[model samples]
Each structure stands twice: as C-alpha cells, then as structure tokens.
Target: MTAEPAVVAPVLPAALRERIVAEFPKYPEKRAVLLSALHFVQDTFEGWIPQAVVPEVAALLGLKPIDVWEVIHFYAMFNSEPVGRCHLRVCTNLSCCLRGARGIMRRLEETLAVRPGEVTPDGNFSVGEVECLGSCGTAPVIQVNNERYREGLSEDDLPGLLDELRTRLAEQDAAKDEE
Candidate 1:
C-alpha cells in the first residue's frame, strides 16, 4: 500500500488547547470531544472552521484530520469560511416556505443588501438559506447567529429586525471602541 503524506498540525493557543482537554472527561472517549472541540476552535477562528483548524483538532483528539473534516462538512452549523459577525439564517423548507419564508428572505436581502451565502459589505451580517430549523410549528423562522430564532416572521417584520440588528451592531462597535 502507498503511504499517505504526513499531516502538519497547527499550533493552537494554550486556552484553546485547555478547552479541548477540558472536554475530554465529559465524554466516553477522547474522540467524542470532536464536536465541542470544533465549536471552541471555530469560535477562536472568528466563527468559521478553517482548513488549518481541522488538523489541529485532530491532533488534540487523537484522530485523523480527515475525520475532523468529515464532522465539519457533515454539520450545517459549521462554516468552512468566514461568515458575518451575525448570521441571518432563514428556513426555506417546506413548512417555512409555505408560510411566507420566501418573501421574508427577499425583504432581508433588500434590507441587508446581500444575497444568500454572502456577507454584507461591512461584515455585520450574512444571509443564508437553511433547511428545517426544527420549528415547523413556528413556520417561517429566522435564526440569528445560531443563538436565537425569531419565528412566524412576516415580510413587514423584516424592517424592525434589521433595525434591531443594526442597533446591536452599533452597540457592539461602541463597546469595542471603549476597550
């Protein structure tokens, strides 16, 4: 059999290494920490799991880098590239679409001035079309930053949501300025 090329692991910060190590005891095996480890690493990389991060995670969890990549690619929540500081994920599944999700998405595009999968010019927000967000009852749901989801959103609600996001971004910018 032909030998595979050696993989170069990247140097992760002490804190990140510690976080991954900390997750070890919570699971049955070291490899079980892969998901949470990916989350920690992704946060440190500014909300995206970069190619270099895969090998770093693998080295920490005693798995192959391709194993790490498999998890990253399997999950929709994981981003391979940089996304906006805030993600605007609108569910366009059967339930959401039947409930005016398309119109809501259109309004968001007009307001944010970016198409699906594209980040805004200022890096404040990005639009994405996701499948079911597991809220069929609340059809037409829009998730923000994967933190919260606003359900039953109508087209008119778009303006207020965008304004609120802009306000939050401004507040964040102001806080950063003070630091």
Candidate 2:
C-alpha cells in the first residue's frame, strides 16, 4: 500500500508563477525547468524549500510530488527545513579538511553557540558541513548563504568573520523590516 499524493492547492503567487513560466522557453521541456523553479521557490520562502511548496512545484511543473522530492532530496542546495539568515556551510571535503576545515567548524560552532544542524537562539545563524565547494586551491573555504565563499580561513580569522556576518544579518533584517 502507498500513501496518496497530496492534493496541494496552488500557493504560488502570480509573480512567482510568471517567473517560473518565463523559464519554460529556455528549457527543452517543462520538466527541465524543475531545478530553476525549485531555486525560485526556495529563494522566495527562505533559504530552505518548504514542504508545502513541493506539491505546489510539482503541480505547476506537471510532475509528481515524488519527482520534485527526488530532486530536492538529492541536492544539498535545497534545504528541507528553515535555516538561519546566515547559513554557514563549511566544506569538509578532503582538501578543505587537510587545510584545517575542522578547526574552522569548531570556531564557528563556538562563536555562534550552536552546533552543526542547529540554529542559534536568535535565529540569525546556523552551521552545517558540506562537501567540496570546488575551491581546493583556496582550501578551508566556507560558503555563506550559498552566495559567497570565504576561503583560506584561519582560526585567527574566525572572530572577525563571524562579527562581519552578524552585522550583515542585522542589516538584512533591518532592510526587510523597512519594506
């Protein structure tokens, strides 16, 4: 026996719907647009892809919920749960590890007061380990919010880096509030 696919009503707003639809022509098939659609949906919500949007994306893309889930589950970029405004993904791949990635991870956990896979009390930061970010030349790299990378890290650099991130998060919050 199997559970029925969710009967998810359309939740995507007109703007986002248009954005996803606009990408249709660029792809060979509607199904091919799933990845971009997921990215748009995730960006619109938070850093993570909400479960509700999974069925929604499937419906819009003319695919099954399972199809969407497969992509989401396979991709490290798509978070199933809400992450902090600052999602610090430390690369623990071989090159980074050899270059002191573990020390960087420890410093981040200690400075943020949250272990990997946990959000801070203030909901401003979270830490997680990831595979190669493709910056072996700049080993010990940490990717922030999937947008920027700080490479060649040192334990001594942790304090200032964390402080900069905190300030940036605060600024982002303030800008959001102004809107």
Candidate 3:
C-alpha cells in the first residue's frame, strides 16, 4: 500500500502571527477569532486565502481544518483562489437588477474581456456578481477590491471606471516600486 504524502503548514510571518494572536483576546474563545484571523491572512495574500494556510489557522484557533474551510467557504468575501489585483464585483440583487445591473455587467464583460469570476489576461481585473451591496437606494453598484463602492452606476459609466481603476492601480504599483 502506498502512503499519502504529508502536508506541511505554511509559516505565518511574525508580524502577521502577532496580529492574528492579538485578536484572541477580543473573542470569548479561540475559535471565535477565526474570522478575524482569516481576514488578516487574506489581506496579506491580496484577497485570496491559501489552502495551505487552512490547517495553520485551525491549529491557531484550536479547531479542525474543516472548521476553517467551512468559514472560508461560507463567506463570499473570502476567496480560496487567486483573483486579479482589482476584483470588481457588481451587485445583481433585485434593486441592482431593476437599475440595469445586467447592462452594467455586460459592459464590464465587453470592456474587460472577462466575465464574472474571471480575470483579465493582463491580470489587472477580475469580475464577479455579488448578491447585494446593501445600498438599495443606489441600486446598481459595484465594489472595487471589496473596499470601495461605486454606486448609482449606469452602463455608460463602466468604461471610464475601468480606465480610472487601472490608472490608479498602476500609480500605486509605481509608488510601491519607488519605495
């Protein structure tokens, strides 16, 4: 019989480990700190949570790896795979749909040459459809990198928005390079 290969846990950097450990005091139980710890790791990995880190997180929280996996899977915001630098999410809820979100999504696909849950060839942007951004009054809204929201959008607004986002990302990259 062949033996299965062992899995090695990825090492969490001291700073990041410290940050995650700090959250333990805030929660009643170690397991309760899972979400915050996952967020910290995801942010470190630029929005995607590495599969290898699952066990490590579970170990830190005194939970099973499946427990960590369950939480990650439950939340749409936590990505298990890599996404582009710009993860653009268009809301497709009733309010957004009524406000022409479908057209906005089409425009994004056409302009970015990538559909929902896809990244551009150049690795600049990825598109996704989210249920809601909670701005019903704003209707059609898009989130950039899960951080900023561009609300009250029309299909006509997408092209410029894409260009603007690309430019801003480029500038940020340049600044990081200089640093």
Candidate 4:
C-alpha cells in the first residue's frame, strides 16, 4: 500500500525553490535530484533542513515527499534541526583520526562544552563528527560551513577560531541590534 503524501507547505523563499526546481532536469533521475535539493533548502535556511519544505520540491517535480525525506535522513551533511550560524563538521575518518583528529575533537568538546551534534547556547557554533571529508592529506581537518581549513590543528586552534567566529557573530549581532 502507498503512504499518504505529507502536506508540507514550503517555508523556502520562492526564489530559492524556483532556482532549485530549475536544476532538476539536468539530473539523471528524480532520486539523484534530492541531494542537491536538500542542499538548496539548507542554504536557503541558513543551516538546517526542514522536512516540511520538501513538499514544495515534491510538488514541483511530482515526486513523493518521502523520497526527499529519505535522502535528507541518509546524508549527515543535511541537518534536520536548526544549527549554529556556522556549522563545524570535523572529519573523524581514518586519516584525520590517525593524525590528531581525536585530540582536536576532545578539545572542541571541552572548549565548546557541548558534545557532538549539539549547538552552543549562543547559537554561534555547532560541531559534529563526520566521516572522511576526502581531505585525508589534511588529517584532522574541519569543514566550517562548507569552507575547509586544514593543516596541523593544535589543541589551541579550537578556542582561538571559536573566539574569532564569535566576535564576528557579535559584531553582526550588534549591527542587527542597531537596526
């Protein structure tokens, strides 16, 4: 028996939904289109993937919402919850793990005081352990909001980077406050 299609009113901005829908034809199959669609939704949302938004894509392509949901759940890069302003995904694969990924991760947890998959209270940072980022050469690398910073990460870089990001966030917050 077929399941009922979810009634999802897309919260995605019309422009984003239209743009992503335009790209669907270039893909080989409708299933293949899901990953890119999920990325689009995340980017439009600042950081997280909302399942409710899938219905809009489904409506556009005439696919089932469950198909979109399955793809989102399958990929770790796609987050279901609202994350920090900057998403930090540290590679925990063999190469990164062998180098100093473990130590880096430990320091991140301690300094951030939040375990993997948890966002900081300030909503400025969220850290998660991800499989190989294909940056084995840069063992212990982290992909921050899609930008990868590499090389030897000392126990110190964790807090230092966080400080910089927080300061940037603070400045932006202040600007928002002024407005």
Candidate 5:
C-alpha cells in the first residue's frame, strides 16, 4: 500500500500569537489561558474556530490536542465552523421560552430564510438557540455576535432589530473599507 501524504496545519499569525502570549500572565498557567487563546484565534478567524488550528493552540499552550478540543466542544460560545457576520443567539431556556422566545426565534427563521445553526444567503446573519443568557428578568433576549445582549424582545421587535444590525454591520464594513 502507498504511504499517506502529510496533512499541513494552518499557521497562527504573529500578532495573534503575541496576543495569546500576552494573556499568559493573566492566568496562572498556559493551560489556563486556553480559552482566551481560543477566543483570540476565533476572533482572528472571523467568529469560528477552525479544526486545523486546534493542534496549533494545543502546541502553544503545552496541552494535548484533545484538551483543546474538549473545551472548544464544551462551550456554546465557541463555533467550530464558519458563521455569518452576525450570529444571533436567542435564549431558549425555560424563563425565555415561557416569555415568547420561541416565537421570536420562529420570526428570525422566517425573516432570514435560514433555520437555526445556518447562515443567511449573503453570509450576513445566522441564528441559534442558547440557554440562559442570565437575563430572565428581561426574558426573550438575543445575544448579538456573542458580544452584546438585546433584552426584552417581543416577536414584534425582530424586523427592526435585524434591520438595525444589518445597517450597523454595513456601516462598519464601510469604515473598514475606507481604512
């Protein structure tokens, strides 16, 4: 039988490596910095953790590949594949569910024409269900890009919220293009 060809791993950028290294002192050990390193890499890669980078992160942290993989798979905040420019995570736990979260989610699916865990055709937006955004008082919340939380949403709010997000992203893109 013929021998198998070697698989090439993607290179982590110097700046990103530096950033990860910078996080080292904040944590007690390199292993403790894994989450932050994963975040830096994910943000660098535009919102998802590519599988090829897992080994790189493991090597950087002096941990096993499985160690990195475990954390990546365990966290809902981490995406293992490509996502849209805006990922809308709607809270679906009991508190939010009782407060019309499902309706809001359905509206998002219909409006975006993509079901949960799928990206829009233009690659601009995606929707997914998440548990306990910790805003039960403001149930029916949507976390935008895993950064900002939009709380107290009714089904009536989806259209405007989506439009606002689209406009904001477009403006940000325009600014980047000018730069």
Candidate 6:
C-alpha cells in the first residue's frame, strides 16, 4: 500500500486578514463582505480571483460555501484559474466593432501571440473580448486593471501600447517587490 501525503490549504496573509476583519464591522451583513474579500483576493493574486478560493472566502465571511462561488462566477473579473497579471478586456460589442475593434483585437492577439481567454507564456498579459464597458463614445477601448486606455486604437498602435503597459507593470511589480 502507498502512503498519501497530507495536503496543505492556502490562506490569505495576516495583514489582509486583519484588514478584512476591520472592515467586516462596516458591512450590515456578513454576506456583504463577499465583494470586499473578492477584491482583496483579486489584488493579492495580482488580479485574477479564482473559484477555488470560494470556500475559503465563504468561511471567512461566515457564509455558505456556495455564496462566494455564486459571486465569483457571476462577476466576469473573477477568474476560475490563474490568468495573466495584466488583463486587457477589449470591448467587442456593437459600438466597439464599428470602431475598428476587430482590427485592434487582431493586432493585440498578433502582438501578444495569444488569443482571447489565454495568457501569454510570460504571464505578463491576457486578453478578453468583453461586452460593452459603458464606453460607446470611446468605442474600441480596453480596460487594463483600473485604467481605461481609449480613443480609436488601431492595429498599428497596439505594440507600442502593450510595450508601455509592460513597462508600467514592470515598474509596479518592481516597486511592490522592493517593499
């Protein structure tokens, strides 16, 4: 007979723990804390909040296991697995499509060498064809992390934009690692 090794579970860091607890008091109900926990996990994982974490987050919030899972699945931002650290959600709906979004998508895919929903091998970026981001005026826009880079982006302009994003993210990671 072969012996099996015990598996260890991952936990949120202590500082994050305290922050969550401190804010728990602010919400009227325990379930209300779900969004905050998801946000914490999102930032902690450098953006992707996986479904595997649902149970842990549920437990922390004193809610049923399915509660966290529901929210995670409902929200497009929460990923079921690891994704590229720099997520680019391109608007592929009507307005964006009319504004050359197809060209922008092709260029981003060609430049990153990855299709939507797949991350680059370097883990630097991921692309997603999203629904309207409420930016018809800025059709053909992309949401990267918290910043939205817009204004009729074209295939020719993609590489430089990606390069700039990579540089900015490199600086961000460097700064975080320094702390």
lDDT of 4: 0.78
* lDDT per residue (tens digit) for residues 20-61 in model 3: 999888878888888889889977887789887888888888
What does candidate 6's lDDT look like per residue over 44-115, in tens digits?
A: 877877656666778788988787777888988777677787888888999989989988888888878998
The pairs that clash in candidate 1 are: none
Candidate 1 matches the true fold with a TM-score of 0.87
Task: Tell me model 1's lDDT, rounded to 2 decimals.
Answer: 0.85
lDDT of 5 by residue, 62-91 (tens): 999999998999998899988888889999
Write candidate 4's Cα lDDT for 55-172 as tens digits: 7777666688887777778878888888888887888888888888888888888877888778889787888888888877766688788665755676667778888888888998
Model 3: ten consecutive residues of lowest lDDT: 6-15
After superposition, candidate 2 runs with Cα above 4 Å error = 1-9
Look at candidate 4 and give me any clashing residue pairs: 96-140
Point out the worst 10-residue segment of candidate 6 by lDDT: 145-154
lDDT of 1 by residue, 1-179 (tens): 98998866456889999988998888889999888988887778767877876777887888998898888889998999789888889999999899899898888888888987788888888988999999899888999875778988889888898888899989989999999
Question: Each model's TM-score?
Answer: 0.87, 0.90, 0.90, 0.84, 0.89, 0.84
Q: Candidate 4 at residue 119, lDDT?
A: 83
Ranking by lDDT: 5, 2, 3, 1, 6, 4
lDDT by residue for model 2 (76-144), tens: 898888888788999999999999999999888987889877888888899999999998999989888
Provide the lDDT at 178 for model 6.
100
lDDT of 4 at 24: 63
Model 3 residue 23 CA deviation in Å: 1.2
Collision count of model 4: 1
The count of residue-pair clashes in candidate 1 stands at: 0
Stretches of model 6 off by over 4 angstroms after superposition: 1-10, 50-52, 149-151, 172-179
- Residue-pair clashes per prediction, in order, are 0, 0, 0, 1, 0, 0
